[model samples]
Target: MSVRAHIIHAVTTSVSVKLMRGQLAYLRSKGVDLTVLSSPGEELVAVATQEGVSYKEIAMQREISPIRDLISLCRLIVFFAQKKPLLTNVGTPKAGFLCGIAAWMTRVPNRIYTLRGLRLETSTGLKRAILLLTEKIACAVAHKVICVSPSLQARAVSEGLVPLQKTIVLAGGSSNGVDTSRFATANIEKHTDLLQRHNIPPDAQVIGFVGRLTKDKGIVELVEAYQALKNEFPHVYLLLVGNYENGDPIPDEVKTVIKRDTGIILSGFVRDVVPYYTIMDVFVIPSYREGFCNVAIEAAAAGKPVITTNATGAVDTVLDGVTGYIVPVKSSEETRKAIRTLLCNPELGKEMGQAGRRRALNEFASPVIWDALYQLYGELINRR
Candidate 1:
């Protein structure tokens, strides 16, 4: 089949690029010529190369810097001019804003900005003001503004980031849906070797958190909750699976607190998070905020109950009590209560996990997501 269109996705880091590989592969199979461009790194380059997608490394920085940002803008404009992609999809507020501005400058036909989350939520003063302007411009210059969550879409509309008519949410709403088939608990038996390798007892009540161990993620509350519950549930093991990088880093205070808990295991950045999910009984993510916790879905798919904060993106995943419990943001007592409830009632946890798996399969298979995305792309490409 003739390659129907050329599409470009711009992201600031490899993490987004890596996470979207499956999505990209799906698009490629449908006859789209896909090119991914972003900052130079092992994370971005390796995936792009492995997937046989074209990639260009643009010099983009997260921090505010007028001079460096100017050079980065020039580089992006150059890339836009040369590639002239049919649709340019920009991710991350910084790169998205730059891509929008550069696409406008280069007059690319379709400029798309994926509004994952607002970085300004955690900032203050001049920095926050700058981020606000950046998000506004990203929405303004794009032909389409897409929010990954309904809450984000509503916020963007209320803030006038994008005209309400121009914004849309892909899928039922997630950057991409979790692969329930691969992440399912049926593979739990196969992961016994992983359990032995990690030295976790096969029968251990595995309590886990998977993401950057940062203050914003409420890692402090997680440490405190673990400390409070570990004594009561001695068989419970806390597994942390992520490596802090760039904008997200673990606070020293959080580190000091976790050091006091010996049952907690830190496995920095595993390639296959599925095995970890296979071994977990309960998943916890008390994030102060979240674009969306993909791990929560993965855990639910693996027939494991989840306990997460009532933050926008995350709260939607856990159906209160049906799938898992949603605790207050940054509240150790609430998180502890949720954990204790799950640990105390293994049958309830199993039932919730089963409910979660059914929900994911019914609502969020990858094909369902890709169809929505492709329809949106077709609409944008065909629109005047």
Candidate 2:
């Protein structure tokens, strides 16, 4: 069978494409003709070259702009009709909604909607209703709906967005499994220069957080917790490895603390985060919502103990008291306590980190996940 697939997303530089990088290349190697579509940028060219796949640029906005969205839908419909791909997988909110509709209208053989997360979980009033409607529409148009985590699947089913039978969590629960070899503990020595550049003392204990510096990520609480922890452990440094998003702005007080604190290091929008993970002794993601905390697994693969909130997807990522600790959502005191526990007991932290690495190697390896996804695609196409 001649199988052709198209993966669509709103932005080229975003996590959706990053997560699919290895999987896309692996699929291509297995004789699947692959094409990627996103808004045009230098990253689009880079991704196409890296993945060894054809790429088409479609200008799609992340926001709900009716005129632009209509243009994008028309373009996608024409593209799908002409290409007639065997499968089209749409991800991210805007692209999923628009491309799902387009693929459905063009009668694509296998329409896949990757429900990364429920934006409605954090929204309210009319906004929540609108998000719910769009989610329903996206799922309704697709033949298969892949949730990144089981909790997200349950949430969708409970919310009446999609039936349980229509959705599946691929492999265990990660959009992209962690690259264990790349994120392994061996890279720590190699990143000594990076530590020097950042003025991070070699003996300093590091608590790291990676992802957008937005309100929903619990950045405000994290900052407050870090301040409390700093009073106890002066040697502990907070390493934040992401840029701030304008959509969900963090409080001014948090921004002020970030700017004033000498112990806090912010590496804005890094391309390669493996080295950053290497320097961290403990990784923390106090997110209020997530499809799955990819960085948490990446940190685990790097042999660092994790401390994340008991949020839907996040809770699934870390096995509490085994690989890491899970505190209640929005609790700064609880977050501080978790951090202190890890920091105080160095041996315990090391043990947990080792356990996390083992778990990552066994369950969340990239090759394992890629193979599963490839097989699923074959199954999906053959069924069609």
User: Best candidate per TM-score, number?
Assistant: 2
Instruction: Provide the overall lDDT of each model, using Cα atoms, as 2-decimal numbers.
Output: 0.81, 0.85
Candidate 1, residues 1-384: lDDT per residue as tens digits? 233889998898766687676787788777889999888888788888777788889878877778998999999988889888888989897789888899889988888898888767677899888888989999989988888877778777886778888888777777778776686446654478767877888778888899887778877788888888877887888888987665667677777666665677888988878887877888899987666677787777777888988786777678889999999997999999998898899899999989988877776777777778877778778773
- The 10-residue segment with the lowest total lDDT in model 2: 7-16
- TM-score, every prediction: 0.93, 0.95
Q: Candidate 2: how many backbone clashes?
A: 0
**What's the CA error at residue 366 for candidate 1, in Å?**
2.1
Candidate 2 all-Cα RMSD: 1.9
Clashing pairs in 2: none
lDDT of 2: 0.85
Q: Can you give the lDDT of residue 367 in candidate 1?
A: 77
